[model samples]
Target: MREPLFLIGNVNVDLVMGPQEPWPQPGTEVIVPESEFRVGGAAGNTALALDVLGVDYRLIASRGDDMLGRWLAEPFGARAEAWTVAEGATTVSVGIGHPDGERTFFTTTGHLHSFKLSDVLSQLEEAGDGRVALLVGPFVIPALLADYDELIAILRRRGYRVALDTGWPDGGWTAQVRTRVAAWVGHCQHVLVNDIEARGMTGADTVEAAAAIIRPLMPDGASLVIKCGPDGALAWRGNEHVAVPAPKVDVVDTIGAGDTFSAGYFASLVESSDLARAVTNGVTVASLAVSTRPRRYR
Candidate 1:
C-alpha cells in the first residue's frame, strides 16, 4: 500500500510570464513571449505533481474568498472541496522567467498570512503511525509559524510524521531564523530543501557540508534531502548517504522545480522506501518538469 501522505501549506494563484532579454525601465510596460495562469505554492506545486504521478494525499490549506481562489481551485477539482476559506484575497505570485529557466517572483501575502494550526487539525482525523505530513513554506504563514511547536505536537498526537520544506523566508534568513529552522529540523521526520536553502540554513559553504551539518541535527532515522538542481540530489539519514544525478534536458519554466522535486522524491519514497530510488526519481521528474512547457510530472 502507498504510505499515507498529506500536505500542509498555501495553494495560491500563480501568474507566469517572460524570458525577456532586457530589464525594462520603470513605467514602461514590456510584453514577454509567453505567460500562464495556474495554481502554485510549494505545497500546491507538490500537490499538482503528486496528482499527476498518481499519488494519494490530502491538502490542508485555505483559499481566499475571491475570484483568484475560485480559479486556482478549479485545477484541484474535488480534492479542493474541503479546503478552508480565508477572509480576503487569495495570495498570488507573479513569476518572470528568464533565460536557462531562471525566474524572479513578486508575491502577495494574502490568505497565507492567516492560515493556522486550527485549519490543519480540522482537515485531518487521528491517523495511524507512519503517515507523512509534508509542511511547506512555514515561514510565509504567520499564524502557523508562530505556533509551529504546537502544530508539531498536534500532528504527533494524531500520529503523523512531519516533513518540513520551509521555503525561503520573506524577511531573509537571519541568525534567529536559522536557529529556529534547526529546531524544526530536529523535530521533523523528514526535511527537504534545495542547495541554496541548505547552505543558508546551516552556514555551510557546500551542499555536502550543509548535509553533514543537518544530518546530525535530525531525529533518529529522519531523512535529509538536499536538492541540487541540474547536478542532481543528495539524501542523508544517519550514516547512509545517497547521491543521484539528473539527466540533461532543454530549459523551460523553472518555477516550482524544487517543489516538483519534493513530490517526485516522496512519491517514490512512499512506494519503496529506497533512498537511492527516491532521489533518482526526484531528479528525473524535476528534470522533465523544467524541460516541459505545460508541466508533466510523470
Candidate 2:
C-alpha cells in the first residue's frame, strides 16, 4: 500500500464574498449578493480535496488558540495535527470574487508564520517510510522560507517523494526571490506552479517556454506542471511535454481551484505513475472546482 500523503503548510478561514459586477471603489461600500465562511488556505484546500477523493492524508499546520481555530479544527478531527498558538488570532482571508471569475484577497498571516522546521521534521519522523511529503505555500510562510533548503534535504534523505508548490510571493516576484525559488525547484521531485508564477520564475512569456526553463532545474527524473487557468495545464518531464485541455464551464469562484488541482494531480500520479493521466485528472478536477460554489470540494 502507498503511504499516506503528508500535506504541510498554511491553514486559515476564508470569508468569501462576491459575484459583484464591478469592483467596489476605494473608500466606498458595496454589498455582494452572496457570502460564505469556509476552511481554506492552500494546505487546507488540498487536504479537503484529498478527503473528497477518499485518500488518506495528514495535514500539518499551525492555528491560533481562538474560536476560528476551533471551528477550523472541528472538521479535520484526527487528520489534522495543528499546533495551537496563543500569540494571535487564527489566520483569516477575505476573498472578493468578481463576476468575471477574477479574485482578490485580503489576508492576515496569523499563525501560519509560526510553523517551525523542527515541528515538520518531527512529523516526518512520525510519518515513517515511503510517504509523500507535499510542502505547500512555501513563500507564504516565512518560517518555511527560512529553513526550506534544510527541510528539503531532510525529506529527500528520508526517502520521501517531495512535491512543492511555492504559491505566490507576497510582494510580486523579484530577481532575488526568483533565484531562491529556482533553487528550491532543484530539490523537489514534483514542482507545481501557476502560469504567472512559471513565467515570473523562468522569465518566459509562454507556458511552454516557462516549462522548458523549469524542467532542467528540477532533479533528474522530476516533473514540472504549470496550470493555465482557463486554457488547462501542461506537464514537462525531461524531453517530454504533454498538454491537457480544460473543460469549458461556467466558473463560480476560483479561490482554491489551483490547490484542488494540485491534490488531484498528485493523487493520480501517486496512484498510477502516469504523467499524462495525472494532468488530465488535475484539469478535470479544477474544472469541476471552479464550476461550483466556493469551499465545496466535490
Candidate 3:
C-alpha cells in the first residue's frame, strides 16, 4: 500500500503562452501563436503531477468562491471536492515561454493567502491512519508561517513525515522569513530546493555547496535535495551524497519541471523506500517535463 501524500499550499489557473520571440517589454505586445491552460500552483502542481503519475495524494488549498475556482477544479478530476473555497477570486498566473521552452511567470496568488490552520487540520483528519507525507512550498502565505511550529507538531504527532520545497522568499516576509524557514527545515524530514533557492537559503555558491550547508541545518537524519536543472540533482542523507543524472532530451518548456521532479521523488518513496531510486525517479520526471513542449506525465 502506498503511503498517503498530503499537499498543503496554493491553487491557481495557469495561462501559458508559447514561442514568443525575445519576450515582451512593458507596453509591448509579442505575438504568441500557442496558448494552453492547466491546473497549477506550487502545491496543486505537485499534487496534479502525483495524480498523473498514479500516486495517491490529497491537495489541501484555498480556492475562491467564484467561477475561476470552478475552473481550477476541472483539472483536479476526482480530487476537485477537496478544495476549500474562500471569499475571493481564485489565483491566476500568466506564463510566457521562449522557442526553447524556457518560461517566465507572473502571478496573482489570490485566495491562497486565506488558508488557516483549521483547514489544514481538517484536511489531515481525512488522511486517517495512513502514513502521511506533508509537502509545503514557497508560495504559502506569510501569516501561515506563524503556525509553522504548531503545524509541524501536529503532523509529527500524527506520524507524518514532512517535505518542504524552497521557493522564492517573499519580500513581505521581511527579516523573519529566514528564521521561520529554518525552523521548518529543522522539523521536516526532507528539503527540496532548486539551485537558486538553495543558494539563498544556505549562502552557498553552488548546488553541492548549498547541499552541504543545508545538511547541517536539518535534523541529523534529514535529507537535502538540490535540483540543478539540466545538470540533474544531488542529494545527501547524513554523510552520504549521490548525484542523479537527468535524462537527455530536446529542450521544451521547463515550467513545472521541478515540481514534477518533486512529485516523482516523493511518489517513488511512497512506492519504494529506496532513496537512490527515489532520486532517479525525480530525475526521470523532470527530464520528461523539460523535453516536452507543454509538459507530459509518465
List the pairs of residues colliding in candidate 2.
Answer: none
lDDT of 1 by residue, 214-282 (tens): 888989988999888888988887778898888888878888899999889888977798888888899
lDDT of 1: 0.86
Q: Report the number of clashing residue pairs per model.
A: 0, 0, 0
Which residues of candidate 3, in runs, are more than 4 Å off?
23-28, 126-130, 172-175
Model 2 per-residue lDDT at 135: 89
Q: Is candidate 1 or candidate 3 better by lDDT?
A: 1
Residue 164's C-alpha lDDT in candidate 2? 89
Model 2 lowest lDDT segment of ten? 78-87
- The order by descending lDDT is 1, 2, 3
Candidate 2 accuracy as TM-score: 0.94
What is the C-alpha lDDT profile of model 3 across 52-170, one tens digit per residue? 78888777776788998898887776676866787888878888877776778888857767777787776666334546555565445655655767877787777677788868876
Instruction: Show model 1 residue runs off by greater than 4 Å.
Output: none
lDDT winner? 1
Error of 3 at 22 (Å): 3.6
Q: Could you tell which candidate, 2 or 3, scores higher by TM-score? A: 2
Score candidate 3 by lDDT. 0.76
lDDT of 2 by residue, 1-298 (tens): 1668888888899998887767667999897888889999999988888888777787878778788988888889875554545367888999888778887889887878777787676555643476778889887788777998888878878877788888888787898888888888888888988999999887889888888788888889888889998999988887778899898988887888899999888778667878999899988888898898644545
